[model samples]
Target chain A: MIKVERLVKAFGRQQVLRGLDLDVATGSITVVIGRSGGGKSVLLRHLIGLLRPDAGRVLVDGADVTRLHGRALDEVRRRYGVVFQGGALFDSMTCAGNVAFPLREKLRLRAAEVATRVEAALTQVGLEGMGSKYPAEVSGGMRKRVAIARALVTEPEIVFFDEPTTGLDPILVNTIHHLILELHRKLRFTAVMVSHEIPEIFEIADTVAMLHEGRIAEVGPPAVIQASPNPVVRQFIRGEPERAEGA
Target chain B: MTERPLPLTLRPLDAIGRWAIAVVEALGRFGTFLGQALGTILTPPFKFWAFVDRIHYIGYRSLLIILLTGGFTGMVLGLQVYFTLVRFGSEAYLGPAVALSLIRELGPVLAALMVTGRAGSALTAEIGIMRITEQIDALTVMALSPIRYLVAPSILAGLVTFPLMTALFDAVGIFGGYLVGVELLGLSQGTYFGEMQSFVDLSDIMTGFWKSLSFGVIVTWVCTYKGFTVGHGAEGVAKATTDAVVLSSVLILVWDYFMGTVLP
Candidate 1:
């Protein structure tokens, strides 16, 4: 389980996260949904230790990740896999090289073992026979798949996806969503994904956290969040103005 | 008595103070990054293969340009010096003049500037693109340090390659001078070669080596630091590349002048 308590983060004068608290249960897919630039990505960065919070403690499995540094922080990070919004696949590397990077860097696996794992991860992402292609040579969807493969190759205990479906068309979005579901079903790693693909993402989410301003306005199961009594939550989910404004 | 604002007429001073602070801050950041890169280089689990690859990239890849620059510079120096020396009845000294100037100054300075324009700009753009594209962040998340994986090899390669390139530049330049002064200008080959051999000293060659070494550090440091701290988006990458090349060129010249006064 991961616990975030009173997370406060500011960039210069702009306070992005203000006393935000969240709990991510073990082996659950917790999808954080918010408006663009509403600190969803910032929160995801903090969770992965990519950005430090100004004031907060992020406890991952009871260890305070924010307090850890150097080798200790690396030890914590080794348990994580992240798929950035842009895929972030190293352009210089082929798909196989990209997937094998973490294994080689962190584990020092033999060449043959690295190859086998790279191939298996590529196959898992439906990218078999495509390992030789560079990230630039691949389509956007294909690059994202390669990124996914790279993320999963390490068999991390936790995975963070940042806007995994941001720029995809509906068909591609559906494909990616299903792919996430399939991977979750197979590995059951704790997943925390920041996305704006509402209603669709709700299908895969075991819990939905709605961030408004810098705090969670509402959080629960999809059905419960769908029926939230909060006006702000309603305004956000409906993507419309409150009807009782005149009163 | 009514109080008067102390800086009402001192706005320029205030602006100057702010500018100084910003410059100092930038310098401190660069120093920190350099220290980090050097520390990573000195630590264990050294990536010798990566260093070798960067040497090829930063040095071997820059050979053609350096050669061309050196050759042209020497030819021009030889032609100009012959004409000027003839008026003073010192035409026999043209070889040493060309050889000495090339060895001590132009070879190291021009080669460094050329490499900065070629390899240094590329390095900056590559790192800046990696920064804006989140590749650096990806490395961090994978438990890799960008300084260790990216900066150290390039820095070490520059340090190792600059003096060697300056030597090559001096050789090629002197040959170009010989071709022009002896072959074309009708000066005896013996006289021209002998003059250069007698006049040029080991200390002059060592001075060129020192200058080129310092130029290498300045170029790589500015370029990599610009790339590593570049802002966001395509505009940021473009700006960083331009800034890296421009700043490194200026700093190389300034450092060369300072080293001229400091080194014998």
Candidate 2:
């Protein structure tokens, strides 16, 4: 449902994505894992036209997402859900209001309809009762779940999670992973999760793409990647403890 | 060891000159921005109540403090001027001198400075906070132009508030002048009123009011631009807020000088 071809993104002199190519298939979970500042977020931002690629193109569905402008661009944005890092919830709003924001802002749905959908999405993320809680009042795990609810509130064709499991406790991480699996089985919507939550991602993500040194080093199923002889692939899958020592 | 400095036309010195030129260019750009914001206010699709609501916040709500400041400033100025003139036994002229200086100069300048402290910093901090938090981005993504929703309301507020603020300052300051002239300094009330009426024309008050109106525009423009253009992170918000206040104050002063020359 999404494609990036020879994407060249740069910040003044330093290039973040040096002619990197990636594709996210329809109704599939594609997890992108990479080192920090390795163009994972840049690539995702390009998908939503938040950060314009210096060159090449990002196609969402069939439209050139990089080329869409104004109302047309916003229309494209409505087609996807984005869960930003740190949740990025509006502090002024409660969890329900946060989820309902896009519905009210973009879809112009009636208040009742918006609330109904928000509750349903919250239930999907196992956050059915925490709707009225403010961001500060909620736990970190709940905030992330609320963010996921906000992302899925639109019932978009695709959902993008910047990092689903980064700050979560083990139990919460497992919950999110199982929720992803459950959502995949039920909704069958396209999901692209950029994460260094390697193990949980392997448990849920059908296709894993590893970005390395400004390009995709490997793209395959979890087992195929596990046995791959590529030094970068092996080291990445070795998880944080070994990698921190390597660093 | 480093060599001597380069000439004005040469690389290093030329860079300083270039930077100076850039600052001037930025000022010109800000002027254009002010013009555009003002133009938008006069054109179609005016949100009338929104303007009134803002004026109520920016002007009426802040009036008490403004009144106190203006009253004290005039009282202080009256005492100083009267006492100084007493040394020459020309204390009666104190009325005309205080009237002219306050109406011609101090009124607008002080009002604008106060607004810079209150509204300009408020606008910058509000928008700057919104910016780093992606609220502005969220607005745009929702098909709301940040310029219309965020900026235009503020510009309208500043425009309406400054003149009203000046009016308050003029009244309070003149009252303070009377308090000092008639009560404290032992000058007659009749003589003080007569001197003020005879010396200060409608044009002098108009000049001060008009100068403040322009100053208000500059204040909102600088603050809104800085807030909307803040870079990522906390430091950027701090820098934007600081730049907004400083730039607004400087613009008010510079425009004050220009009005001094241009207005009657």
Candidate 3:
């Protein structure tokens, strides 16, 4: 559903994404695993048309989103839903309001119809009847669920999760991953998630891509990636630090 | 090869040059931001409800502060002008003096400054928080223009509210002057109002109107721009809010001076 070709991005003197290439299959959950600040979020931003690549192309459904802007870019983005690390739910809005936002903004649904979808979305995320509660009034786990509900309410063709499980407890992380898996099973949206959850991500990801030094070091199915011989991949999966020079 | 550093005498010049360049660059960015914001605001698919919500937030909510400030300012003017005029044996001119100051200059300038401290700061902090927390990004991914969703409405509200609030301030201030000059200071009620009626004209009211209208744009433009471009994190938001309020206040005063000089 998405293809990135030789994507290069830089911040001042620092080069973040250097000739990076990635492909996301339709109806597949692709979890991009990398070290913190390895341009994971930056790459995701490029895919979602939030960041313009210095030299590259991001093609979604055969159209290069990198070249799109204004109404064209917006048309492409209309099919996209993003979940930021902080949930990014509007604090002033209730959970239901947040979920209903995309629906109301994008679709010309009646209030009754919007409310019905919001209810279903909340319930789907196991937060039934919690729509009226403000984001601050909810727990961290509940907030993440609300964000997911908001993202999925529109039934987007593509959903990008930028560390949606970060800052959550291990149990909560597992719960979120399971919830994502359940949703994927039901809706089958093409998802590109940036996470560092290692083995936990492997369970839910149809394909796992390990990013190292601004490039994809390895990418394959979970079992294939687990058995890969690449030292960077092995070291990362094992959660080991780099060896000393000459060691 | 290693580069040589500038001498102490030249270092200050170098610093000054850099400062000048930075200021010019900032001005350029602000101009571009203003253009884009205006463009979005003028485009179709207008957010009528959002605009109305902001009108309430920026205009209606600011009523009490405008009233309080206007009243006190008029009262102070009445007191000071009475004392001054009494020395000249023209204490009856107190009403005209108070009315002219409030209507021509103080009304718009002070109202804008007050709104800057009140609504402007809040707007910056609100948008800055939204930026840092990724809500702005969320809006973008949802295919919504944050400028349209946020900036345009605020600017429109500012343009609408600034003049109205200034007028309110002027009215309240005139009344305040009446209370002080007529009731407290033993000035004749008819003479006080009668002198104001004779002295104040439509030209003076128009001056205040033009000044307030421009001040509205300055307040909303600077505050929204600061918030939209806030750096990052809580510290970034704090700095943006402080900068927004300070810059808006300064610009209001400066613009007031320019309008006072330029307008007939």
Give the higher-TM-score candidate: 2 or 3.
3
For model 3, report DockQ: 0.83
lDDT of each residue in A55-174, candidate 1, tens digit only: 999999988888888889888999999999999999989989999999898778999999999999999889999999999998999988889988988888999999998889988888
| Top candidate (lDDT) | 3
Q: What's the ranking of the predictions by TM-score, best on top?
A: 3, 1, 2
Q: List model 1 lDDT by residue over B52-142, tens digit each.
A: 9888888999999989988888888889999999999999998899989988999999989988988999999999999989999999998
For every model shown, what is its TM-score relative to the native structure? 0.95, 0.83, 0.95
Error of 1 at B175 (Å): 1.4
Lowest lDDT sum, 10 consecutive residues, model 2 chain A, at: A238-247
Worst 10 residues of 1 chain A by lDDT: A238-247
lDDT of 2 at B182: 83
Instruction: Provide candidate 2's TM-score on chain A.
Output: 0.93
- Residue-level lDDT of model 2, residues A18-67, one tens digit each, is 98888889998999998888989888888767888888898887888788
Clashing pairs in 1: none
**Candidate 1 Cα misplacement greater than 4 A, ranges:** A241-247, B1-17
lDDT of 2 by residue, B36-63 (tens): 5667677656666657766776687778
The residue ranges of model 2 lying beyond 4 angstroms of the native Cα positions read A110-133, A177-189, A240-247, B1-64, B84-100, B190-202
